[model samples]
Target: MPETGRREPGAPANVPAARPADDPRPSAPPELDYNGRRHRRAMDDATLWDMARRIPTALAQTARLAWSVDRRMTATILVCQVLSGLGTAVMLTAVSRALPHLTASDARTGLTQAWPALTVAVAAMATGSGMWILADWATRRLNPKIASAADLTLVDLHMKAELSAYDTEGFTDRSQAAEIGAMRAVDLADDAKTLTGGFVQLVSAATVLTSLHPLLLGVLVLSVLPRGLGGVIAARIDYRVHDRTISARNVRGMMRWWLTTSELADELRANTMRPYLQSWYRAMCDRVEGRELEGARPYLLVTLLAASLSGLFTLGMWVSLAALAVSGAMSTAIAGTAIVASQTAGRALNSIVRYGAVMFHHGLYLSDYHTFIGEVRSSATARGTTRAPAPRRIRLCGAGFTYPGRDEPALHPVTLTLERGEIVALVGENGAGKSTLIRMITGLTVPTAGSVRWDDTDLATADAESAWRHVGLVPQKNGHWPLRVRENITLGQPREHGDEGVWDAAGRVGMTEALERLPDGLDTLLARSVWGGHELSGGQWQRLACARAMYREPAVLVLDEPTSEMDARGEHLIFRELRAMARDRITVVVTHRLDNVRMADRVIVLDQGRVREQGTFDDLVATEGSLLGELYALAQDR
Candidate 1:
């Protein structure tokens, strides 16, 4: 009694309804769901020991990256950091040796005796300052190089990945995370340097404290441990908040792009969508801000407790030092020196706590970068070594394709042959597998079942790059490159014959007259956003896309809804050119315009991913009750 696959009354048919876990139909990938799961796992698994372990690993990785970019600069920075630490120790030692002389009862004698020690102290101070300057100079030059290298590596990985990888589950989420990691790579050098500097300072100051008194070193650790623990706790909380709010932040970014982008400005105002989008953006912002505030509460509380404990310990340490002086167990000069060492040690401890936490946080993102690169490299497309010659015939033997995570195939197994110098046209309704079949024929997608071959070379075994040299395709949605018309037509590969070939192709597509009207002719930039650039109308852009494909002079030419936006005259001119060009190339056209099929040598009608009819155009029109005839009659009446 009820219609199959129907929803209940009052349900909107176009809007997607929730499906059961076992549903056979395909659904859009849940991008945020994947992001949340992976990010949560990474954050939740991090423990105190794990954080400690990750710090050195992160520093080593940063060092390796810096070394690869510029080894001389990296070595200079390392030597500067090490020498700076030694300079601090020498300066403190000189000051300690000068204390007794400077404090002697005879003022003139104290000045004379302390002169050499004071001179040594001044020179050590200058050396430390000079090393800081050198390190800073080298870092400024190296950080940009590191960031550029990271960005290039990410782009290279993206170029190598198979086209199908983009549609795979979790791939997009991993890519976004990897991009964040790549951007943070610029911070890696600073984080590592700060961490290294802190550790050096701690070691130098601790050695000075030990020389003064072994018990003083113990007091120093007691005073600083609470603060270090607090920093680690706060970092953990911050990472959790960041992981949880990533999805919401990504949504806000998308909303912001839609609101500000020039391409959508007109439609946004025309449809009065600004307020709706603004409200959506504000909601996501509030969600992220709420999570941050929640995280901040615990962080503030931990820092407060840590600071209170540290203050008490510092007071006790000062009291102990004064008692040692008063009890005559140490001299007044030694006590004063100990005071200076304590202050230096305190500052060094603070640096260690602060920079260590930062390095740990950055390490989490760096992990994402390494994971994504490995995954992409392992899954990169493998083009066979067998070189393929130019195709004379293309054949598909029972080729079918089913998308990832779907039970039903997008296209049924198809058996067909296309010969050079023959023009074939495909007719179909929406979602009738026409585009899928075209992609299979063009080698853009590999079939899940069966094989596609060019001459005797199977696409699965032949070299993809070599086989692609003879194919040219124009899809329904063509790219609008912001380049000069000449470069756009040639796709940056200029022919040896130059503008003569460009003009010939433009004339065939009826674009030569329009191009000639421009101030720079073929040199005109097709981006209105750029200075001195020109823009073309929808029909003119379509004509340009057609001309680009024709310029290739490919052995196989495939056009999908190529003239959808063109006027009657422009459309007629393109079909006439196609008829002439079909004499040498294997041309396949996908169009819903029934009138255009009259120019095709053979017409194949598709319905629900299966071939329903195939014959010459005149023969199909003459047949009684044929699907093509019925579709043509309906179009004529409209």
Candidate 2:
């Protein structure tokens, strides 16, 4: 069945119809067709059409969010910003009107006219200065709003996206860049607002120019006509190209960021990977810039020539007005006014073109944000499906699976059922699908050829959130978050975790002693560069991971080699706590350490993707040549 109406390539020509949320099974009756052909309903024209229709609404929503987020401080700042724009507009008109008057006033019009023109210049400067002050104020007010809006988007991405999205290259890579790039939030909004204001100026300027002399206004409109069209055309093309390149740019950007900063730090130190990362980043920039240049170059070139032509036409219009003055058809003052009006009209058009270009091109990023939001709405999965009649039992029925981009199956036709409220240990050597099985059990991946069921309900249609909320996952290599140690331990929950809960969870995982030793107790920052911060060893962080999971007290606890980094004593303490908590919950432990393999009600030994043996720990060791016994002997290095 198609998910989210996306038409995936290499999918079956006939795809199964999507079942209703209530109906777990396909609705087709027997004898409907021999071919068993199904129509795949994925991303269709209707979806895109709907997007087009709602784009205005989306933009309005974003604008509102942007305003509200920063409005607290923005209100204070915007006054100055608006004043700056208004001041600039006034200064421009005043300067244009006075410049010609002063040039002509020297001999013919004399000192009488020169005095008024000089006064006009002073007034223009004063207004411009005032507007500049307002611009500063606006910047201060608007930046916070931009930051706030970006923060809101980030929060949604963190909470609304599935845990798997953080791992996937598409969602993670794009989302991270968007979040970081969003630091320009206020600037982006200001640019948008400036463009809007520019449009208003263009309208007012045109109206004023028309009043000055109708002939000059007509000439201005006709002369700059091509430039206006060219700008709109160029901007639209630039934006189109920009929209198409988002995923590509995002991938390359993330790869470069990772290589230069976080993931490949060790590798870069060892080799010349800095050069490589920089090279990749350079190539990505070229690709992004190349697309825009290629699309808009012609239009821009044409616009440049059109602007020059508009300037020539303005000169021609001024000459005609000068000729009229000489012929006594108009006064010298009227002729001077025509020249200013012509210049103002031309300048307004120039501003329009530039503003149009930026808005059209940069709006593509907004569309990326838009598309992401749309995808979120239809993210309903069978694994996240809920039911009224279903019981709460986790079952993996004939489950088989494979990771993305892998040829071979991770778990091949492997089936197992972990009954409710039973602690089971999944013992396996490296590459034995232990992690893969746990991921499937936890609804991270759908089974390739089987179904995971909660009670009698198919897990595909089961409420995955409810299933996961009751589930706790502790992985071996979970890293320490660069927050306070307490914050790291409390990420397992949704909200403001308490000091008591933090200590309680730490006590379960034997991290309370470490917390007590810190200067600020649980509040001490854990990252090295952060103020009053302290760092911990790998073993301690692993224990913290366990503590984080225990904080949740989930019904299904999955510990994937959770104690691999911890010492033998540390492992023993954690197991002891688990044994105490195993009374009414399902605790599934995935571990290679035979020492931590103690006391599960049953230990299922997996080998070659099959459960070779599952019984009490004693029974597994009793099997003379069993995998568990061999692993135990290897641990002792016997």
Candidate 3:
């Protein structure tokens, strides 16, 4: 029978209907489809000449980084490189000078005359070898230090970036690329050294070859040009693959984390999700592998063509040298010296091509690092000079927030005031703007429209650091830090009161007994057993989070679903403590547990990003057609 389908009730007409079981159309893997839609900004193709032109800039940047890390090592490496080049030059010159005498008909007399030149040749060779050893020693020590510095810089940048940057599109991908670039900083340094050494060797060999016959220098250039072109092409292909597969690779990493992490272990097995997740992982792997293999095809072809052309040019070069020697246009000794110089020059050229390609590849990543750093710096929050004191009142005047790339605001403009010595309950369904409202009240996010003021001070123009000092927040999803029990409670900021303050906060959340039962009391590490630490149950962790907030004892306290993980007794104890603590500070609690609203001094009900009702719990519950009353009655029935 011919397939037919009808759109589900209220379904958008534009939505496509499902295909039949025997449909012949092929479907792309989800990962591949996602990868295709991403906006890739990979490095573009460049000619060998373009790469050669940019080499000096990359070398200079590497030099500056090396000098900044350790000037003494940089100077030592530079001096050794120059001396090594000079040694090669002197050795070649000495050999050329002694060749004729050593090959003369009266070999004994010729040998006697050649001893001085031979001695110089041996000394130059020894000097070159010594310099190489010293340079290698310095490089081994210096490269690690350079890499460490790069990583530190990147980490510091990440720490200072604004919280909103993490939510921005493409930000995570950029950060990953920057991290890769930072890790390869040492490789760039090593490549710079190789490039410098290759240039010196090329120069030394070219000078000797030119002295023998100018035509040999031309032949040397022709012999290596093909390889250089091939290298540049290969580098472009590699970067293109890297750029295109970033999203797929990142997805694979996330899936691996999901599969391996303890947080999802029980649920994964209970839901029988391993096979599905593994299949997704394998799909991503296959896609990445296919991309890599496809990228390698052109590189292999280029390498073959380059090698073949290079072989032809090299044979012609040797044939020309032999012709000159046989025609007596050059002496046998000069011809023999030319052979050694040609080989040296050829190797130097090959090194330049190989290292230059690798260096350029690393440079692309380095550019990503620099670009991300610049972006982070630009997006970083600018702290105002005005200091903010502990506020007695927080006022939101027509405040609203719209996230990036979205037309509708997550929070609608609604004027509200929260004053000292009041406990306000924010009651709302999911996506009713309760969390967004609390974030605004705490000054965690700046309002895109209108203003938020702490007393008389506008948060937008106040020092964020100073303002945050007065705010204590227990978010819906709290951090599970792998630190000591005491450190977790204090959040690494131990006050002068120390354990006294920690214990007081723990007591308020009824966590003192739980903490005391641990093997090391307050000193016990809070991590999984495999890590030589003890993990806490979900409720215990929630108590720890509440204690952390209580320890701060700030002027403004915000709790979002803080008691969701606790039992009835534990939840009652938390609310009783919050009421007692609310006498001196402003406390805002966001919860769906409508029964808890009776303890609040005032209740604010939100629906669809707007305040729908406001009053005491008794008054709202008594009123007719009240959203809070309706919600509370529904909760009672459930």
lDDT of 2 by residue, 1-638 (tens): 21223335776543534455885332321111212211111112123344334434433544664567666444544454455445545544555555555666366574455567557656765764665466556655666766676667667656655544444446654564355435545466565555545555556556655655566567667666766765555555555565555555767766766764534678787885555456545655666677767767676676677677666766677677779879987666656655554555556666656654544333444555555655543453434447413224677888987655566777886667776667789988888878778877877666777988766767666666666777778877786688877678777586455788888888887887888999888778888644547888888988988888888877778898888778878988989888898765778898776766777888988776667888888888879888788888888985
Candidate 1 has an lDDT of 0.82
Model 3 lDDT tens row, 1-638: 12224556886553445556896432223533253432244336465566676667667778888999999888888999889888888888888889899989999999999999989999998998799779877887789989999899889877767666777888888898888878888676677787888889889888877877787778778767766666666667777887778777877888888888888999999998776666556767887888888888887888898888878877876788788888988877777777777677767777787788667666667777888989998866565778888889999999998776678888899899999999999998999999888878887777889999999999888877778888889999999899999999888455768789989999999998988899999999988745789999888898899899889988999999899999998999999999999977899998888888789999999998889999899999999999888887888898
lDDT of each: 0.82, 0.65, 0.82
Q: How many clashing residue pairs are found in candidate 2?
A: 19
Instruction: Give Cα distance to truth, residue 520, candidate 3, Å.
Output: 2.6
- What shift in Å separates residue 211 of candidate 3 from its native position after superposition? 4.5
Residue 256 alpha-carbon offset, candidate 3, angstroms: 4.2
**Could you tell me the TM-score of candidate 2?**
0.65
Error of 1 at 582 (Å): 1.8
**Lowest summed lDDT over 10 consecutive residues: which window, candidate 2?**
36-45
Residue 377 local lDDT, model 3: 83
Better of 1 and 2 by TM-score: 1
Error of 2 at 75 (Å): 12
Please, what's the RMSD in Å of model 1?
Answer: 7.5
Model 1 bad stretches (over 4 Å)? 1-37, 40-45, 233-249, 272-305, 331-338, 530-532, 606-612, 621-638
